[model samples]
Target: MAGQLSTNSTDHAHALARQVRKLRETRGWSREHLAIEAGISLSTLARLESQSVAQPGFFTVGAVAEALNVSLDDLFRSTRTNPGLWSAGYEGRDIDSFVASLLDHGIDMVADVRLTPISRKPGFSKSRLGEALSQAGIQYTHLRALGNPKDNRAPFWDGRVNVGQARFRDILRSAEAQSDLNRLTEQAVQSRVAVLCFEKDEERCHRKVVLDTVRERIVVEVQSLS
Candidate 1:
């Protein structure tokens, strides 16, 4: 009967919606928490997930991607294939899809390496970012020692360095810094690890320094979680 066919179609659609919702929740994200990250209204996520609306707009998918810190490719990745979380880029600040990618890779920790750790961007800032990650099933920790100094290693700047570039090697060569990087890599080998910073541009940020140090010790695949 036509009624039976329609019911089957609705069931299938709801099943997919449930999959998407469960994936995001696995990271522990609330609809509101995800909404803020994606730069969308809470009502939008509520409607999408609750209604199981088929073919949600591209902008929504993109926003969800940004919130989750993953890519569109990552969002739809079948769990039957990839069993872990991975790094991904954003399109429309899609936190949902981004979280979906994290779910894909099984990312559990975020090691932040920002020189300033401040941000004009919403989710990139320290506290907000940490909370968002926590809501998304990722642990957050800031490693200030691994970050670049405002003086760029000037001795007199923070008075921690004896001279210019003196502190460079300290930050570059410290046990704490090394420990952080090593810990990150260990996570990558065992789980997924994301390096956090304010700037979207990886090269401009001190995350590179931590990444370089990470590379020296372990075979971590560097990724821009922008």
Candidate 2:
């Protein structure tokens, strides 16, 4: 019975891995993007997808489901039999374009990591943006804690400001930042979440700092959508 149980578990893990790969491929997403979205370590995702891990934990599996915007049951079922799931990170374009992009990518949640959620852009301000997203059946959350400190951000500015990877590395060492990152990870584990900020170029934005920090602890694939 013990041997049989072990064998069953292994089979289940392999099946789940296959399903994960299929869903990712169907949406033209890379492993890195899926890992970031799922808020799991890239190494963990690699092992799970490669069937190197005999049994991934329940929470891990559930996180992957949430990132993919599917239920736990869906992960175990045949991909053809389950609803298609997709998610991607997006920079806020015009309200109309931004909302359209979210809908286009099947993103249901947006994690705004901007220091200030207020935007001069029409319909992109916190209140208006939330209403717009709600009407489109998408959820919006502002993670102000994830924003880089104003002092830290100054060094990155030039003709065009860039997010200093080294500076971000130092900021993430703080307990407070780690706590906020933990919260963001939890959110990502619950649904299809996009990390949002003002800068259209992800490299130029501090939102990338948050994403990179999360990537260190959990394997995740990240993409920049302008």
lDDT of each: 0.55, 0.65
Question: TM-scores, in order shown?
Answer: 0.50, 0.56
Off by over 4 Å in 2: 1-92, 159-163
Number of colliding residue pairs in each model: 28, 11
Error of 2 at 107 (Å): 1.0
Expressed as tens digits, the lDDT of each residue in 55-170 for candidate 1 is: 66778877877677777676655322211223332334544555556544545556666655666655656677666655554556676667777767344334533353344556
For candidate 2, give the lDDT of residue 213.
66
Q: What TM-score quantifies how close candidate 1 is to the native fold?
A: 0.50
